[model samples]
Target: MRDFPSRRRGWWARQTPRRRVFFLALGTLTVLIAVGVGAGVGVQRRKDNGPAYLVDPTTPSGPPPDAYPPNPSPNGTVWQPQANSTWQIVLGSPITIASTATSTVPDVDMFDIDLFGNSASTIATLHKLNKKVICYFSAGSYEPKRPDSGDFKKSDMGKELAGWPGEYWLDVRSSNVRDIMLKRLQLAQRKGCDGVDPDNMDGYANDNGLSLTSDDSIAFMTYLSSAATSLSLAIGLKNSLDIIPEVVNMTHFAVNEQCVQYNECKTYTPYLDADKPIFHIEYPSNSPQLSAGDVSNSCNTRVDPVSYGAGGGTGTLSTLLKKMNLDGWVQYCDGKSSTTPTES
Candidate 1:
């Protein structure tokens, strides 16, 4: 989500010199107005949730060893998603799954939703309709609103994310953090999730304020992949492009965002080459009322002879045109749009 709040402007919007200067002046004015109003502009507030508690108390704590065993995959029986698999991701809220319904509104093969927001019953309902459930969570950031937010130690946090308030980059190397993430993984397994989509794994690529490196991300993926494989849950590599070659073999699929807009879709072709689905998302300007030019640009762009996988071939992406907030509304390359019913 471009490391920002859901409603914030896209990075591409500020690339022009005119917009950059305008935003700079606007930012200065906003800061000045905040100071005049005696408001805490950049401070992060932690929720009063009594005390830090583990999400999955039965799961063991502590970080895994530096070098762990290889993931039991490709040979092991895990749910491996194929290329060009149709899907929908709605993190803005939980989707409403009717028990008696024969299929979802979009009738996609997969549904990726917030891990904490969804219940096991919801996942089971999706399963009844023969849809795979991919639970979504942030593995490399501390979000204060999460149920297990208090579980994170103060020392385990770095600087706040630039545009996302109350969210801070996490020290992925910390045992406490890894322990918390392990519990999250266990929660996903317990919730009957077919797979887990762990976001913010690319903290090393941002101004994380923690001296995070690409090597640390690679190691973190290793740790997560081992735990997920053990739980018989498929895990996806989320936007850690720099370490794709290292971790692609371990991960079952790729959950990517803005690859097409950033002209980096080719970077994720490794997953396609491995016969893994690249569940891609693109947030076009003025979405929910997308222009024809915008739709054409998003769906018809070819990187290395690969399109959005309408034909389902090697180097193609299973792309979905979505709003930045990732609500139920979704548009496909075939010019079909549908809104999966979500809980209010």
Candidate 2:
């Protein structure tokens, strides 16, 4: 996966010695907040054990269950993609389909594109081509340029995302932030998206100033899944493998980046164990120059068979080779390559 913007040290290293002293003082505040939120949840757990962190026991318990409706209608009918569905993602730019009447390239089942970058017409056009759409948006960070940027209160913002500019980690516990995300889901619902690719769900794993815990991330995702399901839009957990066991049931699928590079693909098999998809992407070292070995390594599934052999070995994953920018250029495991048309 592309390194997250704002390298935790890159930013600090760029600073002069005097400036480093200044930020270290600020980092102390972050430490205090992290300690106050309760420590020990940061340790990564083995796939067999699931996440070391569980939901905070002190959280208020809501009302008990009402029987699920036989045909519980969310805002619309939810469509869950298959575990092995082939897909393409183009988040860097808006795609210019060759023809509005029919798709001419990439015989993939689904297309994941940025929510705000493309319009409802783009989604409608994809529908005509029999392709499913997964709308992507930052669910755990505040992007300053989004139309709803103003919706985030100052208090809701936290440390700048490592390596990313104008983006800040959000306090997922904030009701206001949750409300804004609900509105984004509404937009997805209106645009006829089949599912949502919520990015930055792993803020707790970062040096976020808000002291967000795994419980907080779990709570946020739980709320997002329920909200998306209520809207008839499928929600996929994005890259927060640490809490997969806690939330596998809540999400319809998973979108992973650079799992092979980090050697953590095995940790995400819980999704496949439950018959959910893991849509994986790997940014090749050489853009457009992917070798056969790149394909083999990226597509390899290495998991402990003893722990997860419930008819589902390791996990089901669909790998896509993409440039770090994630434009239209793509290569499959077969080494076949194609570049979708993009507007100049």
Candidate 3:
């Protein structure tokens, strides 16, 4: 996850402001890796914790939690998180979550997407089909391409994001960072997302440079979840298996990637115990855009060939046989397929 965020930052940062805002807004679930983190490692600190908040998973927003956190969310969107829902996570470039195709991917649940990449009209399209929408965001780390990058203070940053060139780590402790995130959530409401997916929330799992502890991530998630709930926006946990037991109650679903490949799917089963969906993905085809052979072997549970392109091919299909961009094109176990790209 850290690698995905670290490497891709350069690709994102160098883009024009419009494109940068668009990509980061999409909340592409990139961990610190090659393409997204092109800049040096970035680490930032937290301050005074965060605003206090509260929500009833079964109830839409009403009031903010008393004490600690500030009043209302950044934008005052009221949302509630829930369960047994289905989902898809594709944050890479160009994945279209806002298509007008009346048809669905066929099966399971809801759709999670880049908050920026998806538009208000796209959300309306999904609602027409009775599906809930989850907006994605980076609750951790600093991406050079984000609209709020300039909002981050050098004093609040630390480390080189390693493989990423244009990016660096962010101090989660910064008041500036929290404020920016609050604004992003507000936009989710303006865009009409039912829930929110904040990626890279696990600072405890990487070379984050902030000397960030699991406790730090836990506190942060608690803060974010509570705030999201207050806005009536359902909230979820993205791939922080270590803290699931502690934060599960705060989240409505578990958004995960590569859980099958890492042999760690069991860690998220608790979400199932809680009757929540663990949105799982494995790069069976190296990239989502699988070569026929790659798709055949990987999908069949045959041997994993080293030559099989890893991340690139998986991006195209692993989620819905659509690319990392999450376009409407999708294929399933029965060899079914479809394509529908969203238009803003």
Candidate 4:
């Protein structure tokens, strides 16, 4: 065998240089192909397990160390909405209001629309009509369709929000996440929004895989409230009923949904006591064609002890009856309904 190896070496030394070079190149390519296949298998294994970020708890998992300061004096520069203020929220699509139009359909004190869907001119038009504008955005969730969605790192996301596709619960403690929200608040400021309706602030109350707690939500709200105040924008506490007592003083109002259906309307009476408006919404089964029962259930739901007494009187709830999609169609407690025109 030793003699055979020596003979093979001698034969290779005598071969043409081109042939030797070709064999060496072929050997390198074979090794490279093997390595590539092994790497691909490793990646596939990781994918099968889950995203690498999900497995690695590299980011901080709990509320930040610095506790949100005690609720400071109310910012007089920001809008302080009163209790029982009239409003309409059209988040299904952008409302269409012409510059020459005299007034918006279903004229209310304020209009809540999607922050990214509407333009500065639309806000200006609403301003000309003497109506306040509340820009809406998701603060505690990762929405893939948002313009800044790509800014979110995989490490900052957790479980997908139930019943909402392509929307995931965000790690509220992530500094990167808070930075993106600050930018969103800046956008609202530039767009002339009188207030902001930051939705999905109750991630801790859901099955968020990030182990978020009420403290985390409270800290996140503190950050949001501070940022919005600095930008001279009013912020609303959206559906975070568990943390309402902690954050209601910092927020300007409450943008609640389905509180009546969930029998949690009483939880929001704090806003009423603080003279803050509860911009409540209830999604009935047949909206725009609401039955008397639907109207009664939504518009007549008792929220407080005094106004909504045993007689089922209209309370401080800035109530609106609409479809689940939250389109322009709005029905009031007085059995009046109107559809605000929207852009296709």
Q: Candidate 1: global Cα-lDDT?
A: 0.84
lDDT of 2 by residue, 1-344 (tens): 78755675577676799988888899999999898666544332223333333233432342223323223334457887887789999998988774445664588899999999888888888888899999999999999989999989999999999889999999999999998998899888888888999999999999999989999999999999998898788999999989998998888889999998899988876776776778999887886886788788877866544566465544467888899998899998888889877766
How many residue-pair clashes does candidate 4 contain?
0
Range of the 10 consecutive residues with the lowest summed lDDT in candidate 4: 64-73
- The clash count of every prediction, one per candidate, is 0, 8, 89, 0
The digit string of per-residue lDDT tens for model 1 on 118-153 reads 999999999898999999999999999999999999
Q: Give the winner by TM-score: 1 or 3.
A: 1
After superposition, candidate 4 runs with Cα above 4 Å error: 1-76, 305-315
Question: How much does candidate 2 score in TM-score?
Answer: 0.76
* Each prediction's TM-score versus the true structure: 0.76, 0.76, 0.64, 0.75
Score residue 179 of candidate 3 by CA lDDT: 77
lDDT of 3 by residue, 1-344 (tens): 34675466766565899887777756655644544453322211112222222222333353445333434445566544344344555465434443556655553357777887767887777778787778887778777787777888887666766676756666676778777888887788778888888987776777877888888888888788766777678788888889988997788777766554565655654555555555555455545556676545434422122233232211112233344445454555445555444443
Each prediction's whole-model lDDT (CA): 0.84, 0.83, 0.63, 0.85
**What is the lDDT, from 0 to 100, of the residue 260 in candidate 3?**
46
- The candidate maximizing lDDT is 4
In candidate 3, stretches whose alpha carbon ends up further than 4 angstroms from where it belongs are 1-84, 93-101, 104-108, 286-329, 342-344
lDDT at residue 86 of model 3 (Cα atoms): 42
RMSD of 3: 27.1
